[model samples]
Target chain A: MDAVRPVFYVSDGTGITAETIGHSLLTQFSGSRFQTDRLPFVDTPDRARDAANRIRAAGEAARTRPIVVTSCVDGSLTALVAESGALMLDVFAPFIEPLERELGEARQQRVGQAHGIVDFDTYHRRINAMNYALTHDDGISMNYDEADLILVGVSRAGKTPTCVYLALHHGIRAANYPLTPDDLEEERLPAKLRQHRNKLFGLTIDPIRLHQIRQERRANSRYAQLDTCKREVAQAEAMLRREGIEMLSTTHASIEEISSRVLEHLGINREMY
Target chain B: MDAVRPVFYVSDGTGITAETIGHSLLTQFSGSRFQTDRLPFVDTPDRARDAANRIRAAGEAARTRPIVVTSCVDGSLTALVAESGALMLDVFAPFIEPLERELGEARQQRVGQAHGIVDFDTYHRRINAMNYALTHDDGISMNYDEADLILVGVSRAGKTPTCVYLALHHGIRAANYPLTPDDLEEERLPAKLRQHRNKLFGLTIDPIRLHQIRQERRANSRYAQLDTCKREVAQAEAMLRREGIEMLSTTHASIEEISSRVLEHLGINREMY
Candidate 1:
């Protein structure tokens, strides 16, 4: 096994943007193993010193210069991290100058502004979307009129998480309904779902994968059997085809991917950050 | 305002990974305006042609070449997007060959692998964490034993969304409690919260900011009054200090920032992808 190298994602705010980009970069180096740590809210000189010390200690322990990916808006703090005897990758520094030149204005060097709660309207929209997803999950509420999208799938076909992700990340109101055996038996969409046909998107999965997922939750049950999963997926897919609704398979997709595809398919432009 | 550039996030599967990285890159260019579109699930040659046509149309309409950021693992689809007369930024293509060389294995050219539901364990963990956050929110449940972190703050200090973000993004089981006026009057930590002191993290905000946030939710109410907000914030900060709990201000922080800071302060390592 390759020795794990210490990797730090440092930011003056939440460090999520740094981590997201850093993780993408790290994923490309398949031979390297990384022990990642996030250091967020390092807004002060004192905190910067502490982060530098931590980075130094990590490098010493690993016997190699640690990789520090940072997105600090504060120039002094960015300089401090760069001088910490580590391989520092400043995510923001390289682009800020070019952006300033392009836009003909000075960049805001304020900490946390990039991901801050400065826009309460956007924040409330996200929260309201999340609440909507939670309330309308699993057909618990028949409030399709309020939903920007409605996902239909068999059990464990990745409906709930996708809805949650859509709601939380993009402020899109998503509701999900599980297509149960009862709904599949009739060879037709549920009455409630039929009324919101325009809002409905279907998700189908490979039976083998669906069975494996179901077995984890309910081992040895009839519902977890391969035949049951096969039948359910087939019926659900047929129903979607019959209704002329676009569908996607969740077999090899992440919640992020599923939500994005749904949005694209629905021709809904994502709300800006 | 600057003329808006057409920006396309294109992918063979879900365009989320491309969009995420592209969005981070664009954030640095604060002066430029971008009209963004997501084209997902371009797995087939026909769909790729459609995407290329769309990009061409967008560029022609804007009278400037569109910027295309893509994560299409399929070579043909990627090539098609590149030939679309746009400034192409292939996120996955630049690193795949180097990774294959380093790992001594041929890369899996599977679309959607980057954000697939291959790890059922991680999926379940995230779902479980989300359920935990929902059940334990607002001190509605005293199940702190299962909570990895409990956030305490005055009402509308941005607790619920932070908890939801932590759970959904990082699979962190977070609960939140609102520090009410009743708790502040006693000048002591709530008995239920004191028992779980080790898990507690405080969230504070500028009184004016808190008042503004509260006014949106409960307009013309005592809870939204500036004086009330000032008193509650003062009491909450003092109580957190007295209890020796680590606290962060959400006045200028994003939910991502707040969650990441909370995780960092708690010294909890996030589960890796």
Candidate 2:
């Protein structure tokens, strides 16, 4: 069994930024197991001290120094965490000084600004894009005119989640349309989709994976059969190639990967959120 | 106007993780302007050299060392990036050595494992949660039995997006139901929601903000009126208080913040994705 180590994500705010960066880095090490704790809203000096004590306790209990990944912007709070005798990786400390020098501006050292809702315009744009994605999901609404990208795929080919991710993360108005059996039987893109073919991006997956996914949704059904999935995927791939649309396989790609590929293939520049 | 500094997010894979961490760090410096470029799939030494050249060019043009935040796990690739003559903050490099020593094991040094589809169970859970959120959005489906959480809020109070975020990021099965005018007028919890009161959470927002959001959705409608928004918000707050359910205001909260608060308040531990 892999040894378990205590991993702490500490932040003066919600700890999400720390958690995101920490988790991504941790995933690279497949040898060990991590027992994680998130300490959020540790803004005050008292809270910072308390978090440090907790880290010390965790290290003592595990008989190994706990790893702390922190995004605390306050200098004093970050120093307090560093004194906990753990291996501390400060996400902000390494970059802030250089940024200050490069920009010729002092750091604000404001708590929660990194993940807060200070920018209402960007927040609203993300919300609006999400609403757009929901309303236009599965071709329920024909509003492709407003979409920055329209994702098309067979059922369970990862269209909906990718659209939601694009909207939520990049504020991209993404609409997803599922290619139905009827459309696949004809081996042609639907009329409404053809008109917006310029913005069309296709997602394909292995038939076996699609079969397993469908089985989970509806067991012992014709739709969950391997043969059905194979036929549908074949037709979808042909349609994507025939229409000269960029296609990606979701069989081993994360939604983040799919969204990135879609954006890169479309040559869309993402607005900073 | 703030002078723009060139910023680069480089990674061995999609660059989304690097961009996420880099963007969060950069948000701390509100005084400076940034022109960002993302270079993904820089897995090989040759690609790393090319990426370094681009960074050097950006730095030369901007008359400042371009800031490069990278998540490259390969040693040679990271070394090549550090030689770019840019201010590089390697997200993975700073922690990997300590983590390796702590675990008493060597890293596999694999590229793109951090954001890949290697874990099918986790990937499926996220997809399942997303589908659940979509099906149960706005009380469209009353199958709250399987919901880990059910969010109740007025229309445009950011219930849908928050639920989707929780589902996508944490693999939490969240369902959101909109509070209608009729329920608010009655000043009572709906019959269907009464049994699941323990799992219910309320979302409220400032009437002015609600009005602005509604105006964008439907201009010149009674639903977008300030008076109407005020009445609905007041009623919603009172109803939440009467029902003894915890509530959070979404007026100035991001989806990440809202989800974190909801999970924290409900004593829910998120399954790390």
Candidate 3:
């Protein structure tokens, strides 16, 4: 068994930024197994000490120094955390001075949360996009006219998760319409979907993969049968190709990859939250 | 007028990690306005040059030096991107040496993607949690028995977004049920919820905020009226208190903050992806 190492993300805020960057770094070092935890809202010196103690205890228990990645802006809090028996990676340490020089101003004081809700408009855009996704999910509402991108494919082609990711992460209004057998039987796109041809992005998966996914949902059903899966996927691909919709095979792709391709194909440039 | 500064998160991979940490750092520079864009998948020399030109062009167009935060692993790619007229913040540059010394090994080769799909198990948890969130959204299904957390709250008090965030980020199966007028007036936890009180979390919002949200859905209706909002919020809070359920005010809280509180309260120590 690989050695188990303890890692902590200590942040004065949600610690999400620390964890995200730390995870990326950890991916680079793949030899040892890591058990990770986060000490969030560690703004005050008291909380910082508490976090340090936890890190120290984790190191002691594991018999290896814990690695703590922090995003705290306060120097004193960071200093306190540095005392822990750990390799501390400060997310903001290198960028601060250069940024201060570039902007010609000292960093502003914050109430200690990382996500900057610069305006209610920015916040509302995320929530509104989420609402649109949920309301138009599974073709419950065919408001394709308002959708920024429409995902079209057979059932379980990884549409809903991609829609949710796009909405929550990029503030993009994404709606998904599943292609049933009835729709797949015909060559042309659904009238509503044809209207939004520019917005359509199709997702296809390996029939074997789709079969495995469906098998878990319903055992031995026609939907889970390999023959039915192959037929539906073939028809779906043909229809998508005939209609000139951009298609991607989601068999081995993560939602991040699929969502990225959808946005790139649609020319939708949005910041990922 | 506030001058617009161009910001780029250029990466050999998704650039999501760069963008997230960069946003936190940007929060400190509150005086300047920033327009951010991401150039992902710059793994090759030609792609790196293209990204560099885009960064240089954005700076020229905006009449300001662009600020670039890159999470590139390839030294050559990083060097190419650095030649752009921008303040380059290399995300991994600060910690690489220290990490190498501590880990006693060089970083592994990656396929230019930040997300480390170490195992399909991690991937499945995220998708499974997402399906649970959708199936159980807005009291659509009463599978509280399988839920890791169940959010009980008034509609528009920010339950759905929190559930989605928890599932997507932490792989926690969170389901939400909206407390309607009838449910709030009963003064006891619903029979279904009572059985799983440990998993129940209540969300309440200010009536003014609730009224504003509801008004957008149905203008000038009884549900959107301020009086109805006040009464419903009051009754919901009272019922939560009577049932000994923990409640939170979602009026000013972001989904990140609320999700953190819920996990902390519930002692769910899952890593954030």
Candidate 4:
């Protein structure tokens, strides 16, 4: 029986979490003596069939008993379990029964929607807006045209982490463009953003704080100087007023509040905790 | 105002999240600038008082508008807000009212109980069991006396992970001892564990899978050979019976299941999830 082996099944979409958890679990049984294999993302029937065949073949070759553990959030989980022909220990199975009982006929359509409630149209729209924000570092033409809301700030004002956090956690499509020296020099909105002036929102902070953050990366560089930070912030704020950009001082707010305030200003739903 | 600075407050515990949120909010201003300072881990009354004094001193020295964004999870959060004497944004403040309304006193107490509960008697018993298991590696006098429960198996039987996981996550002390050729030669419990045998638990697996896991760590070593694994497993089980030790095959079990079964054997509280 020592010649027998074991096989593992991983069928979740984005198999990363499943693989990590499975590895952690298996590492605990060093003395148990088992072999493991992973079959991930079997979303289609043919893929499920292939996985089943592989598991069966591995079992047939085993000299002792066989065990298969599987994880998937989709209905394909049920399909993979049926095909594996080994004892299955399903982690997310308990939630399925309660969901069916609660949703009734709508449960068929609600399969993956337990984790996400927003429609796909809204999801894609937000993703596109965020994509725009990531690419356009300075507020320009697309800032007024596509962004549901625009984030304006001096350099290193934390626009990226906030934008990414909103996108990942709350499905908010947030774009941020920095207010730079040239923009402040002109003291006017960029030509592309002139039409949608009302959609622009600006963030300002204590220059000293901005200086400290800059110093961490550049260490005594011109950009990290306290006097330079003070001057640039003053210029950016004056230019925002001259260009008719509405703004807020980030000196006293939280990310949740800031993101929600932007959403509130734009009349969009705020979904963060 | 240009010469005036801003202050930033950063927390030690949940400050990372607070700073991200605070920065997002600050980016919205089109005009004006300030300074920032970080205040971490002011959860206690004394720390809050110290933070208040520091903020007061910084504000007195600054010429610009002073803003403070804070995040803390204790009653001292409110105390700090009252004492800061600046334009304050308390990030975690919003959570308290909502959680209080949802959980009420009973549920809050229960949550506290879960975190604070430590059965000292059980803890000592488990630690002794682990120490004994480390030395005996088989059912015997010391093993039985020390262990509230004993795990036995061939090499790589996963005793360490299971035992450690129990201790770390659930505060359930566990000790696992391996069965080796020396134990089987005697056809009895190891000399140290000969007295307290009832607490013994044994684990086995499909010998082939055991060989595969062993081969990864020690390729071509006799210990990784299928025949050797099978022989050791058989001998271990035979010795368990000869010495009246109990055993389980871990070839197809998940950690959750293994943990649950162990709890069942020990009459301990099982994890509901």
Candidate 5:
């Protein structure tokens, strides 16, 4: 207990979570005697070595055991930890087993619920927004002019996350309208959004991926079927193209990339995260 | 090439960077179709599984290969990747090597710049802060009233990162002042902060850990010696106690712990990340 040592947390990307959790655990150990040196934003290889060397130096100077907690998207710190010869804890490695169990259960549950279902979570959130819009009408009509961007997507397209991410990270206000069967039959943009065609961005995903994402929330539902997901995505993309509004296929892109691409399209020079 | 699937990114934390890079990579693969899912605040094990299950389901539904790009502090998706049998690319793993090299060079260069220079980056940041404070005195004055807490420590203590983390994560503004030898001799708190004694928090680290962190930054300098580090930390702590301010030793605690504990001491509720 008297031989207290320095603890290290090396995060590969954001370093926010690993750092946060490491701090939590270290607090448990130190009670009143804990101390740490956090090195955040080590996204590049040079930065990881810097963190490793810092750990090594810290170890050499310690009269006791030194602990290093690292969080990275890649296993780049393996060598750094091996070289440092300190007590190393990789925060990410421990969660894999738990995640497996949790996912396994989710898979089984979805398989059981495969009939006549609706994605209530998604439904609820969208409904919540509609309710907000309805209540906040304030005679301040839902003008496309007030929207920074309008998202047109088929049901279960990756519109919600992108919208939320855009709003939260860049402060770009976005309104999303699902291209329901009614909208598709009408063969026109959402009536509320036709006025803001210039600000519209479309999101389309691979049918299969959309089905899987949908199934996880409500298994065995018509919405989770591959054919349904596929048809809706294709029709939605076609509609977007027909409307001549810009569209992004989100079948295999990442949120960062989509947001970046969106920002690029919108010509917005803002850091999203 | 025909069998190649579109790329995808799944993030359990902030999905900003993952999406950005994922999109770029998808474009490089010449696959115009890509997908993204941003799952933020995946703190619990169950939430992690839910995220993984969504990925697996997405893969099963895909007509092509499922290339997954993901980042998580808890490694929840490592099992997901292994079980989903997807081609997983951890973007953050490759950075440590480069970081190691840069830090080694820095240690060599800064070996004699200070006494016991642990946490070289931290030292540099603080020095930068001091420099900035010297010039930008009018910018965001961390008010004594609004500060969630204040930190008192000797030079080289881990005050800056802890404060910064608190500010960024919890919106708790933290202010820190170094207890100098002059203040010890005067037997009083720094005159600038006497009025804010109620909000003061103190930080101390073990001399050995302090020495090690210093040596990493300053290699063989006399100031990097354990004894000197100990003396300063002890003297600074003693002065803090004499002023009747409560202190936490950062000897074995992580930053998250320090911030939370400080918040707890101040009777503040910490926001969930």
Candidate 6:
């Protein structure tokens, strides 16, 4: 932990895939500290050599072998990066061999398409969904006809971030309807949302977490009080239970977790673009 | 090509890591088509068996061996999935041994952290950046002191979506300034943006694509006219060039590609949260 190891993600494209895989792998070694770098778009041999040189320089500076994760489809690029005397891990290579054996066809020497614009329709849909998420956020729009999912929760209960995540990541038209004080008092599904009940997903947080989150927005106010939080959470849970809406707590969960569960429950298995 | 192969992404956590790797691999085999499914949170042995059953059922339905990509760190869960007579690809297992060798310590058998809220600060930063992006989008706020990056472009030239992507994906406080006709004619960045010149990045789009995008918003108006698009884009490009601001064309690039390039240009080495 004292000597931070240098890590590099080298790729022919954006290197995002390489970085994501590297980050996930690093998490398992919690005791180790790593200083990471990204050398993206190393398509040409010159760029690949430069990436290798950078890795070697980092190695000389750190006085240890750098760990390199390469997601390059072209084998030559990965080989060049590995020639820098680093512990190179080809994230896609191990899978490619097995995939070839299964399919009985060789994988093509193509660049990774993790972040490219291969599908214009998908691109537009993401942008459109983002626009939809913005306009329909926080009960601003009662029109839930086009929303793929409608997130219902109390104020400061972590609805907006999840909505944004759903739209931006999954291309889902996610509108959030905050269960206002009046709605909670009614103890019934909002009339407009009742029709779109199939699209409704409820989110709740622990009262303490909710209070803390709200306190950040409005300090020392009734809205941020623990009592108010507990009451609203209890009411929201009761209302959701009565309405037969499946829900999850976002207190310990990430936005990705909440959105993934929502998609799973709804049986939306669309590929993330 | 005639038959759509069935593919499954099984993981102890959200299965996002497995799915992401699978998706990128699938892109390499353009000649093959696939029907993909995600089985997230298969932590328990029972859940793992259920996931395996699902994979086997899909194989039976397709009359072809299914491809299973597993990101489970625990050996037991992955073993259960592999027993279903599918070609199982353990995404994490192959890397663990190498990472262990490099660190001179064993990797933990914990779940992947690709989608979990392991870092509270990082999670909150993402949510806060999202809020900031929303509040500061489309010239909504002139404040730039706090912005990590400011995106300026003509209307519908893909600023808002890019900003949202930056916020939601990279936890970047990205604000967009739509270069209006007035600003284009003046041949200078808006006065408010001059102070934050180093933070400024420009986005441009092909005039025809811009025309098409605008037509969807307000059909048959001057705003959607090809001439208007051409003039605005040309002027915006020239002005950005004259102001010594780096720019990229979003016409053919995905939002992820554009955002990655911007972060690279700005030298922001933030790990995507």
Question: Who wins the TM-score comparison?
Answer: 6
Give the per-residue lDDT digits (tens) of candidate 5, residues A1-273: 354557665554334455544543433232224346655445566766777777888777865556676655455554555467666666545433433342232111111011112233332333233333322222134554655666678765656545544544454656667777667767677677777778878888777767866786579988788887777777777788888988887665544356656765766554322
lDDT of 1 by residue, B156-254 (tens): 888888887888878889999998899998888999988888888999999998898788779989999999999999999998998899999987666
Worst 10 residues of 2 chain B by lDDT: B113-122
lDDT of 3 by residue, A211-242 (tens): 98888789899999999999999999999998
What candidate 1 gets wrong by more than 4 Å, as runs, is A44-46, A73-76, A92-111, A206-234, A271-273, B42-49, B71-82, B89-113, B180-186, B205-235, B271-273
The DockQ of each candidate is: 0.37, 0.62, 0.61, 0.01, 0.02, 0.72
TM-score of each prediction: 0.85, 0.94, 0.96, 0.33, 0.34, 0.97
Give every collision pair in model 1.
A14-B257
Error of 3 at A266 (Å): 1.5
If ranked by lDDT, best first, what sequence of candidates would result? 6, 2, 3, 1, 5, 4
lDDT of 4 by residue, B70-104 (tens): 64544445466547576665544443343234223
TM-score on 0 to 1 scale for chain A of candidate 5 = 0.53
Which parts of model 2 have CA positions greater than 4 angstroms off?
A1-3, A60-63, A82-85, B60-63, B82-84
Candidate 1, residue A123: lDDT: 73
Count residue pairs with overlapping backbones in model 3. 0
TM-score of chain A of each: 0.95, 0.95, 0.95, 0.52, 0.53, 0.95
For each prediction in turn, the share of the native Cα contacts (below 8 Å between chains A and B) that it retains comes to: 0.41, 0.63, 0.54, 0.00, 0.01, 0.61
Q: Residues B1-273, candidate 5: write the lDDT tens digits.
A: 234343445454444435444433332222234455544434466765776676667767765546666544345445554455666766444433333342222112111111111232342333233323222222235455645567777655667645644543444556767666566566667777788888888888778767866776588887788877877777777778788778887665545456655765666654322
Better of 3 and 6 by lDDT: 6
Q: Which stretches of candidate 4 lie over 4 Å from their true place?
A: A1-113, A116-123, A139-143, A169-173, A242-244, A270-273, B1-273
- For candidate 1, the chain B TM-score comes to 0.95
* Candidate 5 deviant stretches above 4 angstroms: A1-143, A271-273, B1-273
Q: How many residue pairs clash in model 4?
A: 58
Please give, for residues B213-264, the per-residue lDDT of candidate 2 as tens digits.
9999999899999999999999999999988999999988888788878887
RMSD of each: 3.8, 2.1, 1.8, 24.8, 22.0, 1.4
lDDT of 1 at B62: 90
